[model samples]
Target: FLIDCFVFFQTFFSSQKKMSTTSTGSRLYESSKAVDEYIQMHYAPQDQLFPYDDQYAPSAGFQFVARTATLCVESFDKFGEIREGETLSALDVGCAVGGSSFELAKKFATVDGFDFSEAFVKTAKKMQLEKKLTYSSLQFGETFEDRVVSLPESLNTEGINFFWGDACSLSANENVSKKGYDVVHASNLLCRLPKPKQFLKDCGEWVVKPGGLLVLVSPYSWLEDYTAKEDWVMGLEGPFEALKAELSEKFELVDRKPFPFLIREHARKFQYGVSDATVWKKKCT
Candidate 1:
């Protein structure tokens, strides 16, 4: 099961990059398969993520994105990071389908969601404008079931915005948020960048405000197609330890734990993973 999942993910990740201007690439992101996969991951219920009744089936891998998002706000409250009744702006980097972005909107004054896929941005914007989204879930190869996702009443969609941009180069997003944000989220994205170290630097330098939070959740599933070996953030040392060393100069580690995620491949198959989640408080310099 695990091997099949990894192979499927490698193929998916390899085709997910944005193409260069000079070259025309296949539009896989616009395909129904791509959209359906994200919808199920982001909007599907916990039971759907772990529907099996057998005790051996994977559990606690559901609601990965939304849970991590809530983790940021909850951590702030737990540590007294937020002032009394203070409002904050947030950025959701690699926000595929906008679940975490909307989750952030529950507490944040404003949230900006950025992704490399135009289809994801379009779908998220549709949900923003219409307050609902219709998608299909794969039951088997070429077989699907129709589903609709409604915007939760608890979320404030007015202050949320979605954009198509690259995590490695977010100048356009930086323009949208000139001052920086109180919280920056990039779940399962570090290993997907060609230059993960630069992304970490950018978070401290421009993406996150001083004395704010940078929430990262990643499995560190480094692949040559997505990231060069030399650019791996984990490096030769232990994964979290190396990441800790990388950000220690600019950020203070506040919390660390494991977050399990699940991706439904078909009705009977699912890809399960455990991501390391870390919350860092930017130094107020």
Candidate 2:
């Protein structure tokens, strides 16, 4: 059953970037256009997942993030209660259009979102602004644009910020500042990388303060080797073992749950499952 579950997740949780102007080559432009189309087709819209109405709650990815967040929050609360008037900060690496960041924003006082794609960042900023307006306690039936223009100062209090960044090379002193974040989240990102152990270690240094939290959720492992360009290498045993070994030394394993979710990116009608989540905390020195 364990092996079967691993195989299932290896197929499931595997799920972007852009450049500027001055493109001269026709082939390059055509390829870029095709890639844009592909991203738009698969990427979930902000409104669809985080609508103005409460009825549109819980997208598949959103659900995963929420579940992970809940676990992280619970772990923190269980270990150390979040005192009143004390602000907590969180980092969402590979935030991808800021849906996860926005979700975390609701829980934390400050959230910094990072993504490699400039286009995704732009859309996420727009979404963030929209969310600010919608949830700003405006009167019923008030127009969002009008309310936003009229109450610009009110939008300033929203608890989220975003920036374009690479997670793999994130620095503790340079990028995030030393001992900065209280919680760090990297969901469904590790399996996409060529060397995930290095990535995980980098993440540990980037956001996790002493006694802070680290939560990672990925359906696929990054231990398997790949030969062909077309073949998707889903598991990497070395990287997985390396992460487990490294984190074990620094972090206390708090709560871990095996979540099963449909892999929407793989074009499967039936839900392709994966071993979904793990949450840990940096040991207090």
Each candidate structure's count of clashing pairs = 0, 7
Q: Give the TM-score (vs. native) of candidate 1.
A: 0.85
* Deviation in Å, model 1, residue 284 alpha carbon: 1.2
Root-mean-square deviation (CA) per prediction: 5.9, 11.2
TM-score of each: 0.85, 0.61
Tens-digit lDDT string for candidate 1 (199-221):
78888787888888998888887
| Model 2 lDDT per residue over 171-283, tens place | 62254545557788877666654445555676555458777888877665433431122323333564345457767877777767776543222211223355557777877
| Candidate 1: 10-residue stretch with minimal lDDT | 1-10
Q: Pick the candidate with the highest TM-score.
A: 1
